[model samples]
Target: MKRYLLAGLMAVATSAIAAPPQPLASADVKALVAPPAKGIKVLALWSLDCAYCEENLTALRAYQRQHPDVELIYVATDPAYQRDALEARLKRAGVDDVTSRAYADATPDRLNFMIDPSWGGETPRTLVIHADGSRKAVSGALTPARVADLL
Candidate 1:
Protein backbone atom coordinates (compact mmCIF):
# COMPACT_ATOMS: atom_id res chain seq x y z
CA MET A 1 0.00 0.00 0.00
CA LYS A 2 2.79 2.48 0.84
CA ARG A 3 4.59 1.80 -2.47
CA TYR A 4 1.40 2.29 -4.46
CA LEU A 5 0.70 5.59 -2.70
CA LEU A 6 4.24 6.90 -3.46
CA ALA A 7 3.94 5.92 -7.11
CA GLY A 8 0.64 7.71 -7.45
CA LEU A 9 2.03 10.84 -5.80
CA MET A 10 5.03 10.89 -8.13
CA ALA A 11 2.78 10.48 -11.15
CA VAL A 12 0.62 13.39 -10.08
CA ALA A 13 3.65 15.61 -9.49
CA THR A 14 5.12 14.81 -12.91
CA SER A 15 1.83 15.52 -14.64
CA ALA A 16 1.56 18.90 -12.92
CA ILE A 17 4.82 20.13 -14.45
CA ALA A 18 4.41 22.65 -17.27
CA ALA A 19 4.93 21.46 -20.81
CA PRO A 20 7.86 22.68 -22.93
CA PRO A 21 7.37 25.72 -25.15
CA GLN A 22 6.15 25.39 -28.71
CA PRO A 23 8.29 26.11 -31.78
CA LEU A 24 8.18 29.69 -33.11
CA ALA A 25 9.24 29.73 -36.74
CA SER A 26 9.68 32.70 -39.01
CA ALA A 27 6.32 31.98 -40.63
CA ASP A 28 4.57 32.20 -37.25
CA VAL A 29 6.19 35.49 -36.19
CA LYS A 30 3.45 37.60 -37.80
CA ALA A 31 0.81 36.04 -35.57
CA LEU A 32 2.64 37.28 -32.52
CA VAL A 33 2.31 40.88 -33.63
CA ALA A 34 -1.25 40.72 -34.89
CA PRO A 35 -3.64 43.11 -33.21
CA PRO A 36 -5.97 41.56 -30.75
CA ALA A 37 -9.66 41.81 -31.61
CA LYS A 38 -10.42 43.80 -28.46
CA GLY A 39 -7.64 43.95 -25.86
CA ILE A 40 -3.96 44.87 -25.89
CA LYS A 41 -1.26 42.25 -26.45
CA VAL A 42 2.38 42.40 -25.41
CA LEU A 43 5.05 40.20 -26.98
CA ALA A 44 8.31 39.78 -25.07
CA LEU A 45 11.43 38.42 -26.78
CA TRP A 46 14.26 37.22 -24.58
CA SER A 47 17.16 34.77 -24.55
CA LEU A 48 18.98 32.53 -22.05
CA ASP A 49 22.23 34.50 -22.32
CA CYS A 50 20.58 37.85 -21.73
CA ALA A 51 21.52 39.28 -18.34
CA TYR A 52 18.39 41.40 -17.84
CA CYS A 53 15.77 39.03 -19.17
CA GLU A 54 14.72 37.64 -15.79
CA GLU A 55 14.16 41.06 -14.29
CA ASN A 56 12.15 42.21 -17.29
CA LEU A 57 10.08 39.05 -17.25
CA THR A 58 9.32 39.38 -13.53
CA ALA A 59 8.19 42.95 -14.01
CA LEU A 60 6.06 42.06 -17.02
CA ARG A 61 4.40 39.28 -15.04
CA ALA A 62 3.49 41.73 -12.29
CA TYR A 63 2.21 44.25 -14.82
CA GLN A 64 0.02 41.60 -16.42
CA ARG A 65 -1.47 40.72 -13.05
CA GLN A 66 -2.40 44.34 -12.43
CA HIS A 67 -3.77 44.80 -15.95
CA PRO A 68 -5.57 41.56 -16.64
CA ASP A 69 -6.98 42.94 -19.87
CA VAL A 70 -3.48 42.92 -21.34
CA GLU A 71 -2.32 39.69 -22.92
CA LEU A 72 1.32 38.63 -22.57
CA ILE A 73 3.21 36.41 -24.99
CA TYR A 74 6.72 35.19 -24.15
CA VAL A 75 9.19 34.05 -26.81
CA ALA A 76 12.63 32.70 -26.08
CA THR A 77 15.17 33.39 -28.77
CA ASP A 78 16.83 30.13 -27.77
CA PRO A 79 16.46 27.01 -29.88
CA ALA A 80 13.77 24.43 -29.24
CA TYR A 81 16.24 21.89 -27.83
CA GLN A 82 16.81 24.21 -24.88
CA ARG A 83 13.11 24.26 -24.00
CA ASP A 84 13.73 22.67 -20.61
CA ALA A 85 16.13 25.38 -19.50
CA LEU A 86 13.97 28.10 -21.03
CA GLU A 87 10.88 26.88 -19.25
CA ALA A 88 12.73 26.60 -15.96
CA ARG A 89 14.08 30.13 -16.21
CA LEU A 90 10.65 31.51 -17.12
CA LYS A 91 9.06 29.63 -14.23
CA ARG A 92 11.53 31.25 -11.84
CA ALA A 93 10.56 34.67 -13.19
CA GLY A 94 6.85 33.96 -12.51
CA VAL A 95 5.79 33.92 -16.17
CA ASP A 96 4.57 30.34 -16.48
CA ASP A 97 0.90 31.03 -17.20
CA VAL A 98 1.12 32.66 -20.63
CA THR A 99 1.76 31.25 -24.09
CA SER A 100 5.46 30.52 -24.54
CA ARG A 101 7.44 29.85 -27.72
CA ALA A 102 11.06 29.10 -28.67
CA TYR A 103 12.94 29.61 -31.92
CA ALA A 104 12.96 26.47 -34.01
CA ASP A 105 14.20 27.62 -37.39
CA ALA A 106 17.61 26.88 -38.85
CA THR A 107 18.08 30.54 -39.69
CA PRO A 108 17.58 32.53 -36.52
CA ASP A 109 18.49 35.77 -38.26
CA ARG A 110 15.56 35.41 -40.60
CA LEU A 111 13.31 34.66 -37.65
CA ASN A 112 14.56 37.78 -35.89
CA PHE A 113 13.91 39.85 -38.96
CA MET A 114 10.37 38.53 -39.09
CA ILE A 115 9.89 39.47 -35.47
CA ASP A 116 11.23 42.99 -36.03
CA PRO A 117 13.20 44.27 -38.98
CA SER A 118 14.90 47.09 -37.07
CA TRP A 119 15.57 45.13 -33.90
CA GLY A 120 19.27 44.37 -34.58
CA GLY A 121 18.87 41.13 -32.62
CA GLU A 122 18.77 42.41 -29.09
CA THR A 123 17.57 40.55 -26.05
CA PRO A 124 14.90 41.74 -23.64
CA ARG A 125 13.00 43.36 -26.49
CA THR A 126 9.30 44.05 -26.16
CA LEU A 127 6.66 44.73 -28.79
CA VAL A 128 3.34 46.16 -27.68
CA ILE A 129 0.51 45.77 -30.17
CA HIS A 130 -2.79 47.52 -29.57
CA ALA A 131 -6.25 46.64 -30.80
CA ASP A 132 -6.12 49.57 -33.20
CA GLY A 133 -3.09 48.06 -35.02
CA SER A 134 -0.43 50.33 -33.57
CA ARG A 135 2.84 48.78 -32.36
CA LYS A 136 5.64 50.04 -30.13
CA ALA A 137 8.95 48.20 -29.82
CA VAL A 138 11.43 48.69 -27.01
CA SER A 139 14.89 47.25 -26.35
CA GLY A 140 16.85 46.73 -23.11
CA ALA A 141 15.54 45.99 -19.63
CA LEU A 142 12.12 47.54 -19.20
CA THR A 143 11.58 50.12 -16.48
CA PRO A 144 8.19 50.74 -14.87
CA ALA A 145 7.74 53.99 -16.74
CA ARG A 146 8.97 52.50 -20.00
CA VAL A 147 6.54 49.60 -19.80
CA ALA A 148 3.68 51.94 -18.94
CA ASP A 149 4.52 54.20 -21.86
CA LEU A 150 4.76 51.29 -24.28
CA LEU A 151 1.42 49.86 -23.20
Candidate 2:
Protein backbone atom coordinates (compact mmCIF):
# COMPACT_ATOMS: atom_id res chain seq x y z
CA MET A 1 0.00 0.00 0.00
CA LYS A 2 2.82 2.41 0.90
CA ARG A 3 4.61 1.58 -2.30
CA TYR A 4 1.48 2.30 -4.34
CA LEU A 5 0.96 5.64 -2.60
CA LEU A 6 4.56 6.59 -3.20
CA ALA A 7 4.26 5.76 -6.84
CA GLY A 8 1.14 7.87 -7.15
CA LEU A 9 2.84 10.84 -5.51
CA MET A 10 5.82 10.47 -7.80
CA ALA A 11 3.55 10.54 -10.84
CA VAL A 12 1.98 13.77 -9.70
CA ALA A 13 5.40 15.34 -9.09
CA THR A 14 6.61 14.28 -12.49
CA SER A 15 3.67 15.88 -14.21
CA ALA A 16 4.21 19.07 -12.29
CA ILE A 17 7.80 19.18 -13.42
CA ALA A 18 6.76 18.74 -17.02
CA ALA A 19 4.49 21.75 -16.89
CA PRO A 20 5.73 24.80 -18.76
CA PRO A 21 6.78 27.86 -16.83
CA GLN A 22 4.46 30.84 -16.67
CA PRO A 23 4.86 33.23 -19.58
CA LEU A 24 6.75 36.42 -18.75
CA ALA A 25 5.12 39.70 -19.69
CA SER A 26 6.27 43.31 -19.69
CA ALA A 27 5.23 43.55 -16.06
CA ASP A 28 7.03 40.35 -15.22
CA VAL A 29 10.19 41.46 -16.99
CA LYS A 30 10.00 44.84 -15.36
CA ALA A 31 11.84 44.38 -12.09
CA LEU A 32 13.33 42.02 -9.55
CA VAL A 33 15.50 43.35 -6.82
CA ALA A 34 15.35 47.07 -7.20
CA PRO A 35 17.99 49.27 -5.71
CA PRO A 36 17.26 52.94 -5.57
CA ALA A 37 18.19 54.15 -9.08
CA LYS A 38 19.69 57.47 -7.83
CA GLY A 39 17.57 59.48 -10.21
CA ILE A 40 14.59 57.53 -11.49
CA LYS A 41 15.07 53.77 -11.41
CA VAL A 42 13.21 51.06 -13.22
CA LEU A 43 14.42 47.52 -12.70
CA ALA A 44 13.46 44.66 -15.02
CA LEU A 45 14.30 40.99 -14.64
CA TRP A 46 13.68 39.10 -17.87
CA SER A 47 14.93 36.66 -20.51
CA LEU A 48 14.86 36.47 -24.29
CA ASP A 49 13.46 32.95 -24.39
CA CYS A 50 10.33 34.10 -22.60
CA ALA A 51 7.55 35.16 -24.96
CA TYR A 52 6.02 37.30 -22.26
CA CYS A 53 9.27 39.19 -21.95
CA GLU A 54 9.09 40.03 -25.65
CA GLU A 55 5.80 41.80 -25.06
CA ASN A 56 7.41 44.30 -22.69
CA LEU A 57 10.48 44.94 -24.83
CA THR A 58 8.40 47.25 -26.95
CA ALA A 59 7.25 49.19 -23.91
CA LEU A 60 10.80 49.53 -22.73
CA ARG A 61 11.73 51.22 -25.97
CA ALA A 62 8.77 53.50 -25.68
CA TYR A 63 9.70 54.30 -22.11
CA GLN A 64 13.20 55.27 -23.15
CA ARG A 65 11.82 57.78 -25.59
CA GLN A 66 9.74 59.46 -22.92
CA HIS A 67 11.89 59.08 -19.85
CA PRO A 68 15.40 59.55 -21.11
CA ASP A 69 16.78 60.12 -17.64
CA VAL A 70 14.92 57.25 -16.06
CA GLU A 71 17.63 54.70 -15.29
CA LEU A 72 16.37 51.49 -16.88
CA ILE A 73 18.02 48.25 -15.85
CA TYR A 74 17.89 44.59 -16.79
CA VAL A 75 19.15 41.66 -14.78
CA ALA A 76 19.65 38.40 -16.62
CA THR A 77 18.73 35.85 -13.96
CA ASP A 78 20.70 32.93 -15.38
CA PRO A 79 22.67 33.68 -18.50
CA ALA A 80 23.72 30.07 -19.03
CA TYR A 81 20.10 29.08 -19.50
CA GLN A 82 19.59 31.58 -22.35
CA ARG A 83 22.84 33.34 -23.21
CA ASP A 84 22.57 33.48 -26.98
CA ALA A 85 18.87 34.00 -26.88
CA LEU A 86 19.27 36.74 -24.30
CA GLU A 87 21.79 38.53 -26.49
CA ALA A 88 19.49 38.41 -29.45
CA ARG A 89 16.51 39.49 -27.42
CA LEU A 90 18.28 42.51 -26.01
CA LYS A 91 19.63 43.48 -29.36
CA ARG A 92 16.16 43.33 -30.78
CA ALA A 93 14.87 45.23 -27.78
CA GLY A 94 17.44 47.93 -28.59
CA VAL A 95 19.17 47.16 -25.32
CA ASP A 96 22.92 46.99 -25.82
CA ASP A 97 26.22 47.10 -23.97
CA VAL A 98 25.74 50.81 -23.44
CA THR A 99 22.44 50.02 -21.84
CA SER A 100 22.31 49.27 -18.12
CA ARG A 101 22.65 45.56 -17.45
CA ALA A 102 23.67 43.19 -14.67
CA TYR A 103 23.81 39.56 -13.66
CA ALA A 104 21.82 38.83 -10.50
CA ASP A 105 24.44 36.77 -8.70
CA ALA A 106 27.46 38.63 -10.01
CA THR A 107 26.43 41.95 -8.53
CA PRO A 108 28.49 43.19 -5.63
CA ASP A 109 27.02 43.97 -2.21
CA ARG A 110 27.48 47.69 -2.30
CA LEU A 111 25.07 48.87 -4.97
CA ASN A 112 21.90 46.94 -5.68
CA PHE A 113 22.41 44.38 -2.93
CA MET A 114 19.43 45.27 -0.80
CA ILE A 115 17.00 44.35 -3.53
CA ASP A 116 18.37 40.81 -3.86
CA PRO A 117 17.34 39.81 -0.38
CA SER A 118 13.97 41.47 -0.86
CA TRP A 119 13.08 39.67 -4.10
CA GLY A 120 14.23 36.18 -3.02
CA GLY A 121 15.55 35.56 -6.56
CA GLU A 122 12.23 35.56 -8.34
CA THR A 123 12.29 36.44 -12.04
CA PRO A 124 9.89 38.75 -13.90
CA ARG A 125 9.75 41.12 -10.99
CA THR A 126 9.77 44.92 -11.08
CA LEU A 127 10.50 47.95 -8.94
CA VAL A 128 10.28 51.63 -9.70
CA ILE A 129 11.76 54.34 -7.50
CA HIS A 130 11.78 58.07 -7.74
CA ALA A 131 14.66 60.38 -6.92
CA ASP A 132 12.99 61.44 -3.72
CA GLY A 133 13.19 57.83 -2.45
CA SER A 134 9.60 56.88 -3.18
CA ARG A 135 9.27 53.34 -4.54
CA LYS A 136 6.88 50.67 -5.74
CA ALA A 137 7.13 47.02 -6.77
CA VAL A 138 4.99 44.67 -8.79
CA SER A 139 5.29 40.93 -9.04
CA GLY A 140 4.44 39.28 -12.39
CA ALA A 141 3.68 42.06 -14.89
CA LEU A 142 2.87 45.72 -14.23
CA THR A 143 0.44 47.65 -16.38
CA PRO A 144 0.73 51.17 -17.76
CA ALA A 145 -1.71 52.28 -15.11
CA ARG A 146 0.52 50.80 -12.44
CA VAL A 147 3.54 52.57 -13.88
CA ALA A 148 1.58 55.75 -14.03
CA ASP A 149 0.77 55.52 -10.35
CA LEU A 150 4.46 55.53 -9.53
CA LEU A 151 5.21 58.56 -11.67
Candidate 3:
Protein backbone atom coordinates (compact mmCIF):
# COMPACT_ATOMS: atom_id res chain seq x y z
CA MET A 1 0.00 0.00 0.00
CA LYS A 2 2.86 2.39 0.77
CA ARG A 3 4.43 1.73 -2.59
CA TYR A 4 1.11 2.31 -4.37
CA LEU A 5 0.60 5.57 -2.48
CA LEU A 6 4.10 6.76 -3.43
CA ALA A 7 3.48 5.98 -7.06
CA GLY A 8 0.21 7.87 -6.97
CA LEU A 9 1.90 10.90 -5.41
CA MET A 10 4.60 10.87 -8.04
CA ALA A 11 2.04 10.78 -10.81
CA VAL A 12 0.17 13.69 -9.28
CA ALA A 13 3.34 15.68 -8.94
CA THR A 14 4.27 15.10 -12.55
CA SER A 15 0.79 16.03 -13.69
CA ALA A 16 0.95 19.32 -11.84
CA ILE A 17 3.78 20.72 -13.91
CA ALA A 18 2.73 24.02 -15.39
CA ALA A 19 2.75 24.77 -19.07
CA PRO A 20 6.07 25.97 -20.43
CA PRO A 21 6.43 29.56 -21.65
CA GLN A 22 7.27 30.57 -25.20
CA PRO A 23 10.73 31.85 -26.07
CA LEU A 24 11.17 35.60 -26.35
CA ALA A 25 14.09 36.76 -28.45
CA SER A 26 15.50 40.28 -28.40
CA ALA A 27 14.46 40.85 -31.98
CA ASP A 28 10.80 40.12 -31.13
CA VAL A 29 10.67 42.61 -28.29
CA LYS A 30 9.81 45.50 -30.60
CA ALA A 31 6.89 43.61 -32.06
CA LEU A 32 5.18 43.75 -28.68
CA VAL A 33 5.01 47.58 -28.79
CA ALA A 34 5.08 48.26 -32.49
CA PRO A 35 2.21 49.57 -34.58
CA PRO A 36 -0.92 47.44 -34.91
CA ALA A 37 -0.69 46.76 -31.23
CA LYS A 38 -4.51 46.44 -31.39
CA GLY A 39 -5.25 46.86 -27.70
CA ILE A 40 -3.73 48.00 -24.44
CA LYS A 41 -0.98 45.61 -23.33
CA VAL A 42 0.72 45.11 -20.00
CA LEU A 43 4.16 43.60 -20.35
CA ALA A 44 5.46 42.34 -17.02
CA LEU A 45 9.09 41.25 -16.55
CA TRP A 46 9.88 39.02 -13.62
CA SER A 47 12.07 36.15 -12.39
CA LEU A 48 11.73 33.15 -10.07
CA ASP A 49 13.72 34.74 -7.25
CA CYS A 50 12.50 38.34 -7.49
CA ALA A 51 11.25 39.47 -4.11
CA TYR A 52 8.30 41.48 -5.35
CA CYS A 53 7.63 39.77 -8.64
CA GLU A 54 4.79 37.56 -7.42
CA GLU A 55 3.01 40.51 -5.85
CA ASN A 56 3.31 42.49 -9.04
CA LEU A 57 2.15 39.57 -11.12
CA THR A 58 -0.86 39.03 -8.84
CA ALA A 59 -1.70 42.71 -9.02
CA LEU A 60 -1.48 42.68 -12.77
CA ARG A 61 -3.66 39.58 -12.89
CA ALA A 62 -6.25 41.28 -10.72
CA TYR A 63 -6.12 44.35 -12.93
CA GLN A 64 -6.53 42.21 -16.00
CA ARG A 65 -9.55 40.51 -14.44
CA GLN A 66 -11.19 43.88 -13.84
CA HIS A 67 -10.46 45.04 -17.36
CA PRO A 68 -10.61 42.12 -19.74
CA ASP A 69 -9.70 44.18 -22.75
CA VAL A 70 -6.17 44.76 -21.54
CA GLU A 71 -3.73 42.21 -22.88
CA LEU A 72 -1.38 40.75 -20.28
CA ILE A 73 2.06 39.51 -21.23
CA TYR A 74 4.50 37.87 -18.82
CA VAL A 75 8.19 37.67 -19.66
CA ALA A 76 10.26 35.74 -17.19
CA THR A 77 13.80 37.07 -16.98
CA ASP A 78 15.05 33.55 -16.30
CA PRO A 79 16.35 31.50 -19.19
CA ALA A 80 14.09 29.15 -21.10
CA TYR A 81 15.74 26.19 -19.36
CA GLN A 82 14.08 27.27 -16.10
CA ARG A 83 10.59 27.17 -17.56
CA ASP A 84 9.32 24.82 -14.88
CA ALA A 85 9.93 27.16 -11.99
CA LEU A 86 8.90 30.20 -14.01
CA GLU A 87 5.63 28.67 -15.09
CA ALA A 88 4.94 27.44 -11.58
CA ARG A 89 5.26 30.95 -10.22
CA LEU A 90 3.06 32.36 -12.95
CA LYS A 91 0.47 29.68 -12.19
CA ARG A 92 0.49 30.61 -8.53
CA ALA A 93 -0.03 34.26 -9.48
CA GLY A 94 -2.98 33.21 -11.67
CA VAL A 95 -1.54 34.89 -14.76
CA ASP A 96 -0.30 31.73 -16.41
CA ASP A 97 -3.07 31.79 -18.98
CA VAL A 98 -1.99 35.13 -20.34
CA THR A 99 0.62 35.24 -23.05
CA SER A 100 3.86 34.09 -21.43
CA ARG A 101 7.45 34.03 -22.63
CA ALA A 102 10.93 33.34 -21.30
CA TYR A 103 14.22 34.91 -22.30
CA ALA A 104 15.88 32.78 -24.95
CA ASP A 105 18.81 35.05 -25.61
CA ALA A 106 22.14 34.38 -23.94
CA THR A 107 22.76 38.07 -23.29
CA PRO A 108 20.16 39.29 -20.79
CA ASP A 109 21.29 42.92 -21.19
CA ARG A 110 20.45 42.93 -24.86
CA LEU A 111 16.94 41.67 -24.16
CA ASN A 112 16.48 44.34 -21.51
CA PHE A 113 17.74 47.08 -23.82
CA MET A 114 15.47 45.88 -26.59
CA ILE A 115 12.48 45.88 -24.30
CA ASP A 116 13.29 49.32 -22.87
CA PRO A 117 16.51 51.25 -23.08
CA SER A 118 15.91 52.87 -19.71
CA TRP A 119 15.54 49.50 -18.02
CA GLY A 120 18.54 48.77 -15.80
CA GLY A 121 18.18 45.00 -15.38
CA GLU A 122 15.55 45.41 -12.73
CA THR A 123 13.05 42.75 -11.78
CA PRO A 124 9.32 43.34 -11.62
CA ARG A 125 9.53 45.90 -14.41
CA THR A 126 6.18 46.58 -15.93
CA LEU A 127 5.46 48.25 -19.24
CA VAL A 128 2.10 49.59 -20.33
CA ILE A 129 1.91 49.61 -24.08
CA HIS A 130 -0.89 51.74 -25.42
CA ALA A 131 -2.81 50.88 -28.53
CA ASP A 132 -1.10 53.74 -30.28
CA GLY A 133 2.30 52.08 -29.74
CA SER A 134 3.47 54.43 -26.96
CA ARG A 135 4.93 52.69 -23.92
CA LYS A 136 5.11 53.64 -20.25
CA ALA A 137 7.55 51.71 -18.10
CA VAL A 138 7.38 51.34 -14.33
CA SER A 139 9.82 49.42 -12.18
CA GLY A 140 8.91 47.77 -8.86
CA ALA A 141 5.64 46.51 -7.43
CA LEU A 142 2.55 47.54 -9.34
CA THR A 143 -0.06 49.77 -7.74
CA PRO A 144 -3.54 50.94 -8.66
CA ALA A 145 -2.20 54.01 -10.41
CA ARG A 146 0.24 51.89 -12.39
CA VAL A 147 -2.58 49.62 -13.49
CA ALA A 148 -4.60 52.63 -14.57
CA ASP A 149 -1.61 53.91 -16.51
CA LEU A 150 -2.13 51.02 -18.92
CA LEU A 151 -5.22 52.78 -20.13
Candidate 4:
Protein backbone atom coordinates (compact mmCIF):
# COMPACT_ATOMS: atom_id res chain seq x y z
CA MET A 1 0.00 0.00 0.00
CA LYS A 2 2.88 2.41 0.87
CA ARG A 3 4.60 1.63 -2.41
CA TYR A 4 1.41 2.35 -4.37
CA LEU A 5 0.92 5.65 -2.50
CA LEU A 6 4.51 6.68 -3.22
CA ALA A 7 4.10 5.79 -6.85
CA GLY A 8 1.00 7.93 -7.16
CA LEU A 9 2.74 10.88 -5.48
CA MET A 10 5.73 10.53 -7.79
CA ALA A 11 3.50 10.51 -10.86
CA VAL A 12 1.73 13.66 -9.80
CA ALA A 13 5.02 15.42 -9.02
CA THR A 14 6.53 14.39 -12.32
CA SER A 15 3.59 15.84 -14.25
CA ALA A 16 3.86 19.06 -12.31
CA ILE A 17 7.58 19.27 -13.01
CA ALA A 18 7.04 18.83 -16.72
CA ALA A 19 4.79 21.84 -16.95
CA PRO A 20 6.20 25.18 -18.10
CA PRO A 21 6.88 27.56 -15.29
CA GLN A 22 3.73 29.44 -14.32
CA PRO A 23 5.38 32.79 -14.99
CA LEU A 24 6.46 31.77 -18.46
CA ALA A 25 3.28 30.06 -19.67
CA SER A 26 1.33 33.31 -19.86
CA ALA A 27 4.15 35.27 -21.51
CA ASP A 28 3.09 37.33 -24.51
CA VAL A 29 6.41 36.67 -26.28
CA LYS A 30 4.63 33.98 -28.27
CA ALA A 31 2.22 36.44 -29.84
CA LEU A 32 4.29 39.62 -30.13
CA VAL A 33 6.27 38.77 -33.25
CA ALA A 34 3.51 39.23 -35.77
CA PRO A 35 4.41 41.24 -38.85
CA PRO A 36 3.00 44.76 -38.88
CA ALA A 37 1.28 44.28 -42.26
CA LYS A 38 3.31 46.98 -43.94
CA GLY A 39 6.97 46.34 -44.75
CA ILE A 40 9.77 43.87 -44.10
CA LYS A 41 9.69 42.54 -40.53
CA VAL A 42 12.68 43.41 -38.37
CA LEU A 43 12.06 42.00 -34.92
CA ALA A 44 14.76 43.07 -32.48
CA LEU A 45 15.04 42.13 -28.82
CA TRP A 46 17.24 43.91 -26.26
CA SER A 47 17.95 44.52 -22.63
CA LEU A 48 18.31 48.02 -21.24
CA ASP A 49 21.76 47.55 -19.73
CA CYS A 50 23.27 45.02 -22.06
CA ALA A 51 26.23 46.61 -23.81
CA TYR A 52 25.84 44.33 -26.77
CA CYS A 53 22.17 45.17 -26.97
CA GLU A 54 22.97 48.84 -27.06
CA GLU A 55 25.53 48.32 -29.79
CA ASN A 56 23.08 46.27 -31.82
CA LEU A 57 20.41 48.90 -31.38
CA THR A 58 22.84 51.51 -32.62
CA ALA A 59 23.56 49.42 -35.70
CA LEU A 60 19.83 48.95 -36.30
CA ARG A 61 19.25 52.63 -35.85
CA ALA A 62 21.78 53.42 -38.52
CA TYR A 63 20.42 50.76 -40.82
CA GLN A 64 16.88 52.03 -40.47
CA ARG A 65 18.04 55.52 -41.30
CA GLN A 66 19.58 54.28 -44.51
CA HIS A 67 16.80 51.85 -45.37
CA PRO A 68 13.67 53.87 -44.82
CA ASP A 69 11.47 51.23 -46.37
CA VAL A 70 12.32 48.58 -43.80
CA GLU A 71 9.82 47.91 -41.04
CA LEU A 72 11.76 48.12 -37.81
CA ILE A 73 10.10 46.55 -34.81
CA TYR A 74 11.89 46.90 -31.50
CA VAL A 75 11.45 44.58 -28.50
CA ALA A 76 13.08 45.28 -25.15
CA THR A 77 13.61 42.82 -22.35
CA ASP A 78 13.74 45.65 -19.83
CA PRO A 79 10.47 47.02 -21.07
CA ALA A 80 9.83 48.95 -17.88
CA TYR A 81 13.03 51.03 -17.81
CA GLN A 82 14.12 51.21 -21.43
CA ARG A 83 11.04 51.24 -23.59
CA ASP A 84 10.31 54.90 -23.19
CA ALA A 85 13.95 55.84 -23.24
CA LEU A 86 14.55 53.82 -26.35
CA GLU A 87 11.60 55.36 -28.14
CA ALA A 88 12.72 58.83 -27.23
CA ARG A 89 16.27 58.15 -28.27
CA LEU A 90 15.24 56.65 -31.55
CA LYS A 91 12.89 59.48 -32.23
CA ARG A 92 15.64 61.94 -31.56
CA ALA A 93 17.87 60.01 -33.94
CA GLY A 94 15.28 60.49 -36.69
CA VAL A 95 14.36 56.84 -36.61
CA ASP A 96 10.92 57.29 -38.11
CA ASP A 97 10.65 53.85 -39.68
CA VAL A 98 10.74 52.11 -36.33
CA THR A 99 8.13 51.05 -33.78
CA SER A 100 8.82 49.84 -30.28
CA ARG A 101 6.80 47.33 -28.28
CA ALA A 102 7.29 45.52 -25.00
CA TYR A 103 6.13 42.22 -23.51
CA ALA A 104 5.66 41.49 -19.86
CA ASP A 105 6.81 38.26 -18.26
CA ALA A 106 3.35 36.72 -18.35
CA THR A 107 1.65 37.76 -21.54
CA PRO A 108 0.59 35.52 -24.43
CA ASP A 109 2.87 37.29 -26.91
CA ARG A 110 6.20 35.66 -27.74
CA LEU A 111 8.82 35.66 -30.47
CA ASN A 112 7.36 33.91 -33.47
CA PHE A 113 8.65 30.35 -33.18
CA MET A 114 9.48 30.40 -36.85
CA ILE A 115 12.63 32.16 -35.69
CA ASP A 116 13.83 29.66 -33.11
CA PRO A 117 12.81 27.09 -30.51
CA SER A 118 15.73 27.64 -28.15
CA TRP A 119 14.94 31.33 -27.71
CA GLY A 120 12.99 30.71 -24.53
CA GLY A 121 13.09 34.44 -23.81
CA GLU A 122 16.61 35.32 -24.77
CA THR A 123 17.22 39.03 -25.22
CA PRO A 124 19.35 40.63 -27.95
CA ARG A 125 17.89 38.17 -30.45
CA THR A 126 16.54 39.29 -33.78
CA LEU A 127 14.83 37.81 -36.81
CA VAL A 128 14.58 39.53 -40.14
CA ILE A 129 11.62 37.93 -41.82
CA HIS A 130 11.38 39.24 -45.31
CA ALA A 131 7.93 39.74 -46.77
CA ASP A 132 8.42 36.40 -48.49
CA GLY A 133 8.79 34.40 -45.21
CA SER A 134 12.51 34.08 -45.89
CA ARG A 135 14.29 34.87 -42.63
CA LYS A 136 17.62 35.77 -41.02
CA ALA A 137 18.11 35.48 -37.29
CA VAL A 138 20.92 37.20 -35.39
CA SER A 139 21.64 35.94 -31.93
CA GLY A 140 24.10 38.73 -31.06
CA ALA A 141 25.23 42.21 -31.91
CA LEU A 142 25.58 42.87 -35.60
CA THR A 143 27.03 45.89 -37.35
CA PRO A 144 25.06 47.91 -39.86
CA ALA A 145 27.06 46.40 -42.69
CA ARG A 146 26.35 42.92 -41.41
CA VAL A 147 22.67 43.77 -41.21
CA ALA A 148 22.72 45.17 -44.70
CA ASP A 149 24.48 42.06 -45.87
CA LEU A 150 21.78 39.96 -44.24
CA LEU A 151 19.23 41.95 -46.16
The candidate maximizing TM-score is 1
Q: How far is candidate 3 from the true structure (C-alpha RMSD, Å)?
A: 5.9
lDDT of 4 by residue, 1-151 (tens): 9999999999887655332111112244444455545567787776555567766766887787777878766665554434466555545445423556554443323433433555665667877866666667768778877888876
The candidate with the higher lDDT, 2 or 3, is: 3
lDDT of 3 by residue, 65-150 (tens): 88887888888889988888887787777667677899999998999888888999899899887778787888887777766664
Q: Which candidate number has the best lDDT?
A: 1
Residue 61 shift from truth in candidate 1, angstroms: 1.0
TM-score of the candidate numbered 1?
0.85
| 119 Cα displacement, candidate 1 (Å) | 0.7
TM-score of every prediction relative to native: 0.85, 0.56, 0.81, 0.60
Looking at candidate 3, the ten consecutive residues that score lowest on lDDT are: 11-20
* RMSD to truth, every model: 4.0, 17.0, 5.9, 18.3
Clashing pairs in 1: none
Quick one: ranking by TM-score, best first?
1, 3, 4, 2
lDDT tens readout by residue for model 1, 1-151: 9999999998887656555689998878888778999889988899999999888887887888899999988889999889889988877876776678999999999988888888898999998888999888899998777777778
What are the runs in model 1 whose C-alpha is more than 4 Å off? 1-17
